[model samples]
Target: MKKSILVVEDQSSQRKIMVEALQKAGYVIFQAGDVQQAIDLINQQKPDVLVADMHLPNGDGGDVIREARQLPGAPVAVVAVSIDLAILNQNLTATYQADAYLSKPFHPRELLKIVEELVGVSH
Candidate 1:
C-alpha cells in the first residue's frame, strides 16, 4: 500500500502545496488546518507520517505528535516545520519529539527529501 501522510498547517496555500507535492511523490495525503482537525483525522486515518508546522491555530503541532505516538501502528515519523527556526528550535528539545525538522522558506525538495527518508522510500 502507498504510504500516507498528514499535513498539519494552518495556511491554506501551504497545505495545498504540500498535499500536491506529497501526492505526486506517491503518498496518500491528508490535511488539517489546526490541532483539532489534525487529531480528528489522525484518529480516523492513522497516517504513516506527519508533516506539521510548529505553530498552529488552536494548539501547537507538538501536541498532535505527542498524541499520535500513543496510537497503535508503527511509530509515526514526524517532520516539524517552522518559519522562525530560532524560536521554534528553542525549547524544542523539551517541547516536542519528531523524526526531523525543516526550517520554513525551504524548497519543496527539502521537505520531500525528509518524507522519503521517513517513509524509507526512494524519491
Candidate 2:
C-alpha cells in the first residue's frame, strides 16, 4: 500500500509546496491549514504520518499530535516544522514526543528524506 501523509501549515504557499514535493515522492497526501482541520482529517483518514507546522491558526501542531496519540493507531510518526528552531527545540523531545523536526525554508531533499525514513519507504 502507498504510504499516506497529512501536512498542516497555515501558509498556503508553503503548504502547496510541501504537498507537491511529498506527492512527487510517492506519498498519498492530505492537507490542512490549521490544527483543527488536521484533527478532522486524522480522525477520518488516519494517514501514516503527519508533517505539521509548529505555529497554526487555531492551535499548535503538538496539541494535534497529543490528541492523535489518544486515537487508535495514531500516526506512524510526526514531524514538527518551524522556523524558530531555538524556541521549538526547547523540551520538544520530552514535551511533544515528535519523531522528528524540520526547520522552515528547508530543502525538499531533506524533508522528503525524513518522510521516507519515517514511513520505511526505500529511496
Candidate 3:
C-alpha cells in the first residue's frame, strides 16, 4: 500500500503547498490547521509520516508529535517544521522523539527529500 502522511500546519497556503507536493509524489496526505485537528487526524488516520509546524493555532506541533507517539501504532517518522531557527537548532528529536526537523521557507524539494529519507520512498 502507498504510504500515508499527516501534515499539520496552521497556514493554509503552506499546508496546501505541502499537501500538493506530497500528493504529487504519490503519498496519501491528511492535513490539519491546529493541534486539535491534528490530534484527531492522528488518531483516525495513523499516518506513516507526520510533518508538523512547531507553532500552531491551539498549541504547538510538539503536542501533535507527542500524541502521535502515544498512539498504538504511531507514525514511522515525525518531522517538525518551524521558522524559528532556534527551535530547529535545539535537540527536538530528543525532546519530542521526532525523526527529523525542517526549517520553514524551505523548498518543496527539501521537504520531499526528508520525507523520502524517513519513509524510504523512492522518487
Relative to the unseen true structure, what is the C-alpha lDDT of residue 77 in candidate 2, on a scale of 0 to 100? Answer: 86
In model 3, which range of ten residues has the least summed lDDT? Answer: 68-77
Instruction: State the number of backbone clashes in model 2.
Output: 0
RMSD of candidate 1 to true structure, Å: 1.6
User: How many residue pairs clash in all the candidates, one count each?
Assistant: 0, 0, 0
TM-scores, each model vs. reference: 0.92, 0.92, 0.95
Better model by TM-score, 1 or 3? 3
Across 1-123, the per-residue lDDT of candidate 2 in tens digits comes to 888899989999999989999999888999999888999998888888888888888788888888667777534588889998784768776878788889888987888989988878753
Q: Whose TM-score is greatest here? A: 3
Error of 2 at 56 (Å): 0.4
Segments of candidate 2 deviating more than 4 angstroms: none
lDDT per residue for candidate 3 within 12-110, as digits (tens), equals 999999999999999999999999999999989898999999999878989999999988853458999999999888888787788888888999999
Clashing pairs in 2: none
Given candidate 2, what's the lDDT at residue 65?
A: 80
Checking candidate 3 for backbone clashes, the offending pairs are none
RMSD of each: 1.6, 1.5, 1.3
lDDT preference between candidates 1 and 3, better one:
3
